[model samples]
Target: MSLKYAVLAALLEGEASGYELSKVFDVSLANFWPATPQQLYRELERLAGDGLIEARTVPQERRPTKRMFSLTAAGREQLAAFAAEPTRRPTAVRDEFLIKMQAMDGVDPRAVRALVEERRAWALGKLARYERVRERLLDGRTEEEYLRDADRVGPYLTLLAGITFERDNARWCERVLTVLGERRAAAGPAGPAALG
Candidate 1:
């Protein structure tokens, strides 16, 4: 998906300055669509130029004017059309960590183990953050009530997917660590190379 659609979808929450939108992307959309602040700013400009979003200049007392953006009708229609399009491409996993794992047998297993542990820790951290986001979204309501009565469920549902992805990642990392530990024990003294 393009950053255009991501920015447009974000504006659905309400009008926001580019800075505010960047924060929203960092917190809420990072799981699915990661963008640097520069990238977001560039996309915002493009979207504005394309007439998909309208920018309002807000004067500040002590600072330079800031531009806040809101989705134009065209933006909404564009997002809707993008959403309606059937996803023809399969999801792809293009992680450098996976490449490192694949080459583990050719390198030091200890190093690879450390990297996997780091990934597991990151996944756990993200899972915790997503849980907090979920709680905030639910706002004291039960999941059923939130899902049934919330004006918008897209954010909540996407957050759920992020939570699940992180949870599964942590679990997979745990299994990998266990298997590596077992193999190390079976190989004895000289490390993984000894198994060969």
Candidate 2:
């Protein structure tokens, strides 16, 4: 998704300065969209120039003035149009490591396993973070609460997807480990897997 739409979606919650929008992007939109602070700031400028967002300088007592941003009518209209459009099919992962794994006969299996292990760990960490955020949001609420407040409901779905994805990655790692173990047991002398 475009940063423009992401910024507009974040501002839909409320008006925010660039710094606040950065935090909002991390906390709220991170599951579906991710952008660095630099990218957010640049997009804010573009949106303001396009008249899609209104910006006003907020004077501060002892600090530099911050430019606060909020969606204008055009911005809201854009978001509405975007929301109404049909979503395309999901894209596949474009990782170069997958290509390397497919041609792994020429490479070291251990190195590929290490890469997979690293990715699994990273995915697990993100899954843990999403779980924490979901717990915080859900609190002790029931399904009724979610049904009532539909605007704040994207996290749980994305969290579930991420958790399942990481869990599958962990399973994949276990299967790979088993295959590697068998290969190691059979090939004793050179241990070609150790090349990595």
Candidate 3:
């Protein structure tokens, strides 16, 4: 999907400044769809030019007036149309680390282990953050309430997706660690795992 669609999705939450959208992109959309603030700002301007989004200047007391953007009716229609179209299967590498691990018989196991450990730590930390955000959004409501009555569905659903993806990563890390340990023991004292 294009960045345009992602921008439209973000605007669906509510009107927001480019800065605010940038924050949303960083937290909510960074997992499946990553975009820099420069790209977001440029796309917002383009969407405005295309009459898909409306921008209004909100005056501030101290700082400069900020431009807030919201989707126009046309933008909403376009989004609906995009959603109605057939979903295209994205083609990309399924897992680079798995490939590296598979070749570890000849490759360096310690290097692969290092990479896995680093990624594990990152995924664990991000999962913790997502959990915190999910709790804050729910505010003690039950799961059924969170699923049925939440106002901000985009963040809500995306946050769940992020949580699931990170959880999967953590599992993969643990499996890899276990497999590495087995390989290390099987290799005895002079293994590639200990060489690095």
Candidate 4:
């Protein structure tokens, strides 16, 4: 999906300045659609020009004037119409890391091990952050309570997906590291080819 649709979905929460929207993307939408601040600002302008969203300028004492945006009726209609469209099939994976993993046999095992360690660290960090978000979303309630009474469920559901993805990543990295480490142990001081 385009940044346009993402922005519109964000505005569905409430009116917000471009800065606030950027923060929202960083928090709630980061799992699905990551956006740079520049991209978000540009999309805000385009959405305004298209009459999908309405903007109001608010004067500030020290900072620059802030423009708060909200979805117009047309924007809601557009989002609803898009939602009605049949879901597309999942896109094919196009990741470079998979290619690197595939070539690990010919490449240096040390480098691949380093990559796995790095990915594991990143995945663990993401899982921690997702847990924090889940806690905040739950507040003092249990999961069942939150799901029953929350105003919106999309963010929580997407966050769950991110958590699951990160868990899988960490698990896969651990498996790769275990295999590589075992080979290194068996080969003693031999080179990568002998380790294989």
Q: Pick the candidate with the highest lDDT.
A: 1
TM-score of each: 0.91, 0.76, 0.85, 0.87
The number of the candidate with the highest TM-score is 1
Off by over 4 Å in 2: 23-30, 59-64, 88-92, 143-151, 188-196
Q: How many backbone collisions does model 4 have?
A: 0
Model 1 agreement with the true structure over 8-95: per-residue lDDT tens digits? 9999999999999888888779888878889988999999999999999999999888999999999999999998999766766678
Off by over 4 Å in 3: 59-64, 91-103, 151-154, 192-196
Q: List the residue pairs that clash in candidate 1.
A: none
- The residue-level lDDT of candidate 1 at 89 comes to 68
lDDT, candidate 2, 1-196, per-residue tens = 4678878877887789999878866754665677789999999999999999999999999998999999999999999898788876474566576676677666677677787788778767776876777677677776578648767665566666766776776777677778877887798867754453
Model 3 C-alpha lDDT per residue in residues 1-196, reported as the tens digit of each score: 4789989988987899999989988876777677898999999999999999999999999988899999999999999899788877673436677777677666577777898899899889989988988898889998688889877566778789889989999999999889988878887877644442
lDDT scores of the candidates, listed in order: 0.89, 0.77, 0.85, 0.86
Question: Looking at model 3, which ten-residue stretch has the lowest summed lDDT?
Answer: 187-196
* Ranking of models by TM-score: 1, 4, 3, 2
The number of clashing residue pairs in model 3 is 0
> What is the per-residue lDDT of model 4 for residues 153-191, given as tens digits with 9 covering 90 to 100?
877887888899889999999999999988877877665
Each model's Cα RMSD: 1.9, 3.3, 2.7, 2.3
